[model samples]
Target: MASTRPRDGASDKGAARSADALLARMTRASAGRTAGILLCAAGAAAVSVALPAVLGRTLDLLLQGHPDAGRALAAAVALTIAEVVLNAAVALLAGTVGARSTAWLRLRGLGRLAAAAPHGVSRFSPGDAATRLSTHATEAGAAPAGAARIVAAVLAPTGALVALFVIDLWTGLAFVLGLPVLGLLLRSFARHSSDSVSRYQRVQSVMATRLTDALGGARAIAAAGTVDEERARILRPLEELGAEGRRMWSVQGSAMARSGVLMPLLITAVLAVGGLALADGRISVGDLLAVSRYASLAAGLGSVAGPLGALVHGRAAARRVDALLAVPPLAHGQRGLPPGGPGTLELRGVGVSRDGEWALRGVDLHVPGGRTVAVVGRSGSGKSTLGAVAGRLTDPDEGEVLLDGVPLGTVAADVLRTEVGYAFERPSLQGATVEEAIAAGAETAPRERVRSAARAAGADDFVRVLPQGYATPLEEVPLSGGELQRLGLARAFAHAGRLMILDDATSSLDTATERQVDRALAREIRPGTRVVIAHRLSTAARADAVVWLDGGRLRAVRGHAELWQDPDYRAVFGHADASGGGGNR
Candidate 1:
């Protein structure tokens, strides 16, 4: 089910605001590099604008047989070299800033994903999130440096236009006459290109999402003999993606084509006007040469569209990246758990809804300190939801949950994490090594404590037999489903506090191992409240009390033997034996 989270409705204004804010933060993070890029770009522009005029004067000096011609020629060559060096510096600084910004953005994105409630982050599929963090971040990170270049990009043309007027007013005026056409071409391209770029990105995101989903379910696809169909489905968006890509190219081509024809005509007109000025004795040969160069520089205004297009792409990508980072994080407060308090977990009128359907509603229950409570229900009967609430992994949409006397929402983030631990059906070991994975979440899980937790989960024996024992690299070790669950259980045990939630965490272990782990929970683990989301009847039987959920509400809180009398409760295990227990391994 798609969980409804606290993200904004993805309104255009909201997304733009978030994108701008995120870009601003990136700009600040790369401030030094951005400043350097701007400095280099400005220097390059100055040299570019000055070099043409100097070269024109050198030509005039040579034509007039002036003694200073050699010195003027040397000066022109020096300016040319300086321009190349400054442009190279600009490129270097831009590259560094872009790399730095991409790293910063990725870290921020990952941090937000980690800090948010799992369900909140779940809104982004693995593929979509991966695309946003990797490709989209790279695009956006290049924007600030790109923007700095735009300043110099614009300055070059404007300065050239001013130099043209100083050389000959008629030539400058002739070039100015065609400026409106150039402006229109760029505007049209920007509008069309921005729209096409945005559509292209959406298509890419869809394909990536489908491909990721297929990879995750590759085994299912293979078993069903539908690998071919899956492949086709994953590439279904290819047509639209190609169409958008072509549209972007067409926009760019049309703009460049128009500019291509218009620039030459404007330059020709400037040259003709300069010739007439030379005929009228209004300017020297040096001034005419300078005017012609200035006219070409100013006429090349069409090239601005290229950088503008990049900025547009960057902004669009920023919106997508910010969408993930903008998910409202689970808010934490300043309160901490009182020292030496037992974890008495209570849910009062707690209700959680998914996709507009209630997963749990008005399901109030309480577990005393140091007691084991098994939450038992049929599939989709809110058992896991209850576990999530008990550990505060997710907050109920309505009402409140409290541990001891403190409200969960009011607890400090670190305090809440330290006091609550969770083990899920599919545990993702966090660290590189086996022992590190087991100790990942604990505030302080020393080597001895890690080994103890592993022993309690029945994982120590198997772990020690592996190639490197506890130090074995997680990826290099082969683990069965049951072993995975044991490691997950060990991780929870290592970090277990006043409240530990095993949410269908032991479903993969055999009955004997499961029983041993259960015994260890009571004997070898911490003395605190344990909320076990159980599917096996034996698990409920071992708990101090059982919380039975019917539909979305709590049906009863009674002993397993007492609740077994109800045929419905027995049928929840998919068996008719009221006296017989159920198990799955």
Candidate 2:
């Protein structure tokens, strides 16, 4: 089952708000850059407006048969030079701001995700998360700056209107008639383009998800001889994605065709009207020419339809980007670990649920400073949940978990994270070298500490056999599942947290190796709290106390020997038979 909720029908107001907030932050973040951008946009608009008027004046001078037509033409040439300079400046600013804004938003989005991810979010796929943070942010951030170009495109029409009114009010009114039509055309394109672009985004997301799944399952599919089936499954979404792309291009192509025809048609109608007015002597020959020039300027309004198309694409991308940024950051609770004690972990009537199904219920457990507690249970019996709760990898749905008599939420995130160490059943190697993996995210851990931990976990021998030994990269050395698990344990050791929770950390080791690792851990358990969640009953048997969980509930808490005599515990360890009680290794 999927782990995250679908965001459908959710209030997008929050997303818009976040986008605004991000922009405000970015504007403040890059104030110097923004000032440069605004100045360039204003310059571009100024030139864009001046160019059409200069052309109108030059045409009017020529029509009036003025001997100073050469001067008017020279003025037109100067206006052209100014237009080029301004346009170039605007383009430079747009590109610079677009790139910078994309970077800012992408970084901001990642920060939000990191802050929000600590909360139990099972459905967040790594592949999808990458898409949301990178590509989506890039597209969204382009919208505001790209709007500058659209602003210039609209300026053409304003300049045209001013020139037309200068020619005659009737001619200007006639030209303005086409404005509504152009708007309707743009509105239609925006609607369809936005819809198609959104669909394309969904299709791309699916293809990405399928690709990640196929790659992750490549080993399984090859072993099962179903490579062809998996290939077909992955290809299916890609094909759909291709089809959607073609559909979007077709819609854009159609919009382009209409724009091409509409602009020239409007121009032709204006010229014919101007020609008639000229014959009737209601407007001067120069006035007619200026009106024609203005009509031509108005025709440039169609140019915005293209940028408007870009705006729609950008807006669609922005909405997706904003959605990621809008996820309320995991409510940051109190700072520092709870007061009144130190390094004593407590689960005061804690429970955890996922999708309304209880994973752990009404369980209260504690590991005081300098003590060890072993949690034993069958698969799906909540042992791991108990460990996760203590480590704060997963928070409790009810009640509270405390470190040193203080609620876990009362502690700062970094403090809680650093103080609690977790070794998972199938741990991930997050670093390149074995040493680096062992050190985890810490800035400093002595080589001796890492090697010592590896030796205690029975991993040093294999690590030494690799080329370059501890310096050998994790990818270069083919470490097996058991080896990785041990390295993961060594990482926890290197971290040396106040409280350590090993959730089935040694499950992959052989009986002898498990016993060796357990003994080493037992020797080192003093002065640091340890909570081991293991399936093997033998491991729990040696603990100071045993916690046996069943059906998401803590069923028994007693010494290993005492629990061995109980029917429920006997059944759990397969010791119900008269032949033998559950043996401890």
Candidate 3:
């Protein structure tokens, strides 16, 4: 069944505020690099505007056969060279800033993902997360450089208009008359293209997520004879993506075409007016030449569409990245745990809800130090929820959980992590080698202790047979279900804390291996409170106490021997008699 979490009215507003703050933070972080890029771009723009006027003067000097023609020519050449140098500098600086910004945003996104609660991270598909970190981050990073180009693009035309007005008022007025039309075209393009680009990106993310899901379940799809259907489903979003792409192209193409036509008309009109002015002797030949060039420059303003589009697309991408960053992380506390305390655990009237349904309700239980308690129940009976609360993997919606009289919510993160260890049914051991996986999170453990932990989990023998033994990379060692479970157990055992909660961590192992592991855990590992979520009746029977949960409520908390006396308790394990005493172990 799909779970539904209740939403608060303030959540949307809060998320918007957080996203705005994140955008501001990113802008601040890239400020120094952005400034450098802008300076180079401005220098290039200034040279570009000055070169035409200089060239005009040089042309006039040669036309009149003046002695200063040589100096005028030299000045034009120097300005051209300077423009080239400035442009090269801008390109270098822009690339540098883009790369740095991408790296920075990617790192920040990863950190936020790490800090978020498991459920929050689970909301994003792996493929979607990858796209955000890579594609979206890169696009968003380009905004600063794109913004600098936009400023330069705007300045070129503005500067040209001013120079034209100073040289010849009639030519300048001709150029200015076309400005409103160009502005209108650009404004329409921006509006339509922004929406289209945003939609394209969203559809791309959806398609990637569907493809990833299909790939992960390819074996199941093949077995079910639904490969074709799955493929079709994954590609379903492609049509929408294509439509959006076409819309963006059409908007950009239309704007560019309009600019292309208008630019030539404006330039021709300025030349016609300049010709009349030259004929009437209202302006010199040099002034006519400068005005014509400035008119062409003003027309080039239409080229702003490309950089402006990039800036808009980048802004859209930044919003997507910020959405991920805004997922609220689990709050931690400031107090540390007392040293050397017993691993006594207590739950006082705890309740938890998921998707608007109570997963656990008004439950209370306690375990003395150095004792093993097995949490057993039917599926959806809150066994996992109990274990999660015990270890502070999550907090209860109501009531409180305490470790040695210290509220779990009030315990500092470092102290809580060091004192409470957890091993999941499917552990993600992110390490290069078997040794490293076991030693992860327990980097201070001595070599001997690592070996001892591995041996206790019955993993040392299999690990030793590998090519490099414990040094063998995990990817090189393809492990069976039981072997993988053992490795996970070994890691948790290596970091055995004052409280160890195993959430069905040993379910993959065979009965014999499980027995050996249990014996080793009792004999070798440090004494601590052990809370095991169990399915087999034998596991519960072997524990010091059994916590039976039913319908999100605690049914009983007693020894397995005492609970087994009830027929209903026996039925919980789907047993008529105790014939299959081990409960499918």
Q: Pick the candidate with the highest TM-score.
A: 1
What are the C-alpha RMSDs, in order, of all predicted structures?
Answer: 2.4, 3.5, 2.9
Between prediction 1 and prediction 2, the one with superior TM-score is 1
lDDT of 1 by residue, 424-465 (tens): 999998889999999898486889999999999999999999
TM-score of each: 0.95, 0.87, 0.93
Model 1 clash pairs are none
Clashes of 1: 0
- Expressed as tens digits, the lDDT of each residue in 1-585 for candidate 3 is 111211223354564466456656766788887787778778877887898899889888999999999999999999989989988888888888788878888998999898776656666677778877889899988887887888878887888888888877888898889889988999998889878887888787787788778777777889999988887887877888899999989999999999999989999988998899899998888888788778877777998998899877887777778767766777889997777877999999999988689999999888898899999888999999898888887788999999999999988887888889988888888788889888888345567878999999999999999999999999999988789999999988988989999999989998888899889878899889999999887789889999999999999999988888777788888875764344333
Candidate 3: where are CA atoms >4 Å away? 1-20, 442-444, 576-585
Worst-scoring 10-residue span by lDDT in model 3: 1-10
Clashing pairs in 3: 4-355
lDDT-based ranking, best first? 1, 3, 2
lDDT of 2 by residue, 346-462 (tens): 888889897689989998877777677889877788887788778776578898988887777767777777777788878888777889888774445678888888888889999
TM-score for candidate 1 = 0.95
Model 2: C-alpha RMSD to truth?
3.5
Question: What is the model-wide C-alpha lDDT for candidate 2?
Answer: 0.74
